[model samples]
Target: MNKPLSILAVYIITAVSADESEPNIEEICRFVAPGTTILRPNTCEQWVRCPTAFGAADYDDGSCVYGLYFNKDTGRCESIENVNCPYESNIVKNRCASKKTGSFLPHPTNCKSYIYCQNGKEINATCPNNLIYHPTKVACVYAKQYECELKTFPANANPICKAIPKNKILADTKDCTKYYKCNKDQQLVKLECAEGQSFDYVSSKCVTQKSAICHPLAPELEPESDVCGNADNVHIGYIADEKSCSHYYICNKRANGRPDRKPLHLKCQNEHFFDINTWSCRDRLRVQCYLDRCEGIENGYVNVAGDCTAYAHCKNGVTIKRGKCGEGFNFDERLQICSQQNISYVACKS
Candidate 1:
């Protein structure tokens, strides 16, 4: 019986420990209730209300509640009644509650004047005559530092009313052809374009010469007209010479602009042939001629003379023979003459 009683006591102690370790669901839910939210993990508190409230009527009692001012004259709490405060106000323990001031509010119409609310009153302020209030800087600054919007003005009018740098060009408002440049004394000096030139607004410069219009051709030959005038009468697709059809010529109109004007002649080089499609010179294999036999005594060839024993050769398209015949003969190519009797012939070999 004693052993059973000790076991029962141990069981009861274990049951009590388990029950104490369990979480309280109802207490946890109450701590998160509305108007009594949980401030932290273990803290549950409501937001505190300031004793003094802005814009509250004064109470009859001398003592103010909710930290409001008890105004004796108005018989109420000092309120933000007459204060035209642009910004939020602060509440103090004293009945006199005033909005925070010194926040610069620029005047809508005047760049020099600014206003601020202080002690329930709007106080106006101004900068120096030449200075303007800068909202970004929150201070007064020279007017030159401000970049103001430009307004419409008459032709050649200097609306800036300030000194412009020398040699600066300014355009006229009413006329596109007129312009002015600032002189050393900051004075406007009118200027105009030259006789044959026109003012180019896009480039802001005077264009003195006009581009010549020419007939279009292949891309490679498009600029040919500029150099050689116009392609009019030349053979369109033939080589210039017979030796090798590599170099080709093109006839271009003269620059005199006359219908009877002669066309200019141009040719490609030796290693290139004129391409009709591209109208440009293209590379090609150079052709050459070589002969191993003599016929008709062609240029640069050696042949047996009419005498059957003597030889004559052609050089530079002209036939030439040895000054004398082989041992006992005289030969003349022009006379077709050869004889052994004319041994003393000075024109023949000795």
Candidate 2:
């Protein structure tokens, strides 16, 4: 008797497990509306409105025929011929009309191309020339990789090209008092100097602008008449030489008596003139100078050898040495001396 009871218990457990795995069709169909039909048997989740003649009985037997779509308004299945639809009704067609016509969208695979959806399909388009399409901006713009040619500008002016010039000054557009310089490869780079420091155009460097004797655009020349000694007596430290505009001098307040004191006279070497920015003498090409004497040479001196092969270096208004051109060259005053080898030193008339 105990063995029979154990067998009965095993049978009951097996039946319960089988029922759990199978879905309940009757319960699923009870929730379905009267005019709707189940999409499939056993799995009674999907339901769609059926033709007026089809009912629950036909739906359970799977005898109801479904059309392309169901009309919720009419409570009936619809054939493709009976259905009327707009082009934008589909997802692809809608996106094509709205996104493609309204704005540009970048392609998922290519940086230079853009994608547009049309007629339930995706269309790819490319930007013009070397330009790239920017999705966020929705427009074709210049590519960052391309390098443009450099442009020229007048003195103390802004640049047109994106490329920055190496050591140049430009007044700040926002603030006239501030200035900027170009860094390597980066154009219109803002130069931030330390406190009390300012950009010097002559030197192409940064210097302390406060308490400086000479301003960038207009510099004051040192006065020769001050007799009082000490730093206070000196208004300007350097000034262009009165005798020769090509030379400059520094104020010396500690010399001689008051009112007749003289400043230390100085001259630029090798025909260079005073550069207000550098506060030193530089080549003629780097700085502009106007005088009757030859440029890049000391004042009141000439290339004694008329072939322009050599010249005399002068100091303190006197010739110190006979300067010679490099080997295999003759200095011609007309050719600006030592710049070219048009004439041989031996054959040159001196």
Candidate 3:
């Protein structure tokens, strides 16, 4: 039986014979398709060796075609195909992978890899631009490659933008409090409401109650004041009291003379004024009111009996306790104890 010729034996013979027809660049250029740019040359073949020419191949690292030797240029591999054609082993100058749109010449990063060069455009691409044909992934992928100039893109682009994928857009927080960035420029802002609810630009997270509430700082009569009347009319000599309410002047033995009284509205009978000298009102005939009114001196309080009830004190709801002179006596609101210091009376809490 005839032994089948081993494949290695044929390959060895072919390799040797292929080395014999090495041609010069002139002959190599002829084999290149017309208008095709021959960037480098083949160097593996021995007979094809020639002196380097202008734009000729440079030192090639073991890359050969049909045993034909070629040189390298500009970091590209040079080699000859069958001694006539020149090709780059490291990279292939190609256009976009899309056969439909004849793309511009592309210098793919990896010689073995293919890149998207849309419609003969040399610009890098984005979402709509030419995509990357990642051999490992074995599928077309959309890259956010910043090479895009403005709005140009490739024709066979996949993963066409579906409203920016909704995941990328984030709201604008005026305080930079929180935000999100999408592959596309769509965003929404978010914040926390005072009511401890999360809120977004579209709506409030916490609904507010609608009823009106009383203010804690509402204005009211001072609880410590001996009298509760119009605050503007309390001071004497500042204004003339109207008729029965004539503004009275108080003489301060220390402050030169009595303050000139000016006209003012009427004030209730139970009013008070701070004495500049004594700093407290007294119940002497000289210190008493011009209208025969009682006064309150230090440790003394005017009583309802029309007596000088000294040291009288009022509790909550104005339950006035008579001074020592009227021991065991306290004013009762039910009895309207405005005159006598009456004990055995109960005062209600407000």
Candidate 4:
């Protein structure tokens, strides 16, 4: 330029120059201020401050990184430090795996441990601070996170639930008359009727189809002339008059042999006798049957051959022959006459 600018006054742009020479002071002053953020254009490398001066821009290997810069002196990476970093750069480690990132499984593996590396070798590489690796979910989570595992569930996962059809089996359990059991197809079927009873589905109450008969309760039998008396002391009986059409019976044991027996004798007529014993008379006609013969009435008879005879008076002084006045003269009370004699006189000769 004019008189060739002096070396000290020469304006040099080191960002564009290929030579490694002294950097311009104005360029260093322009980059070192606070809130400066930039990277090298060619390499895209990033650093927190200016390479020539401290507190210039945020950068890492030509790519700009985000961090707060601390001092404005000593223009190098050692001189410029991050004010907001929690730990050293080589301590945090991240893990990624196929099982974690696959679309079928939505879980992911995050930063899992603090791994310190020096000279390309691991130092104190430990698992994450308060977490462990879950093999099922393939993710790092806090320790003892889950109480139960999926495999230990009560039901299997394959079969989907469905609404079952309504049927008789469910209803049979409520009011089943017959004993029922489930078939292979899960249907209720009748086995048999219960003991001592047969099933009647229509009635739904157990029934005895045929029942046994008990003996005729307290039967009483007596002779033809006598009334009903206690046969084997169970049923009582009595004697009835021959002329009476009604018969009598006594059922009260206390009044059976008692002298005050009028209260116990329930005298019932022939019409009532049929009703009490549930029987009917077969011999409809017999003149002697009108009288209920007691002992000898079956053989008892009265013979009337002719009209009334006379009463012959027997005196103590008179010699009465066979209770007649004379052999052929018979005295009659009804006619009071001694008719003309026709003598068949054997008893009169005495």
Task: Assess every candidate by TM-score.
Answer: 0.17, 0.18, 0.17, 0.13
Total backbone collisions, model 3: 38
Model 1, residue 78: displacement in angstroms? Answer: 43
lDDT for each residue of candidate 4 in 61-104, tens digit (9 for 90 to 100) = 33323222221122222211122111122123221211122212
For residues 270-329, write the lDDT of model 1, one tens digit per residue.
Answer: 435445445665542122112211223355423232333353565543446433356666
User: Candidate 1 or 2, higher lDDT?
Assistant: 2
| Model 2 lDDT per residue over 1-350, tens place | 12322332232223222122222333222222233333322221123333323123443233213323322223344432232211112212222332334344455335677766565345778889878776567777787743323222222222211111234344332322245544443234455444344444333345655433232233332333332233434434666654453577675443432322455677877546576556677644344333323433454444453344666565554566667788776655445556655653322344
Ranking by lDDT: 2, 1, 3, 4
lDDT of each: 0.35, 0.41, 0.28, 0.27
> Worst lDDT window (10 residues) for model 1?
37-46
Q: Cα deviation of 171 in candidate 2 (Å)?
A: 60
Consecutive 10-residue window with the lowest summed lDDT within model 2: 156-165
Clashing residue pairs in all predictions, respectively, total 14, 14, 38, 18
Query: TM-score-based ranking, best first?
Result: 2, 1, 3, 4
Question: Compared to the true structure, candidate 2 yields what TM-score?
Answer: 0.18
* Lowest lDDT 10-residue stretch of candidate 3: 155-164
What overall lDDT, based on C-alpha atoms, would model 4 receive against the true structure? 0.27
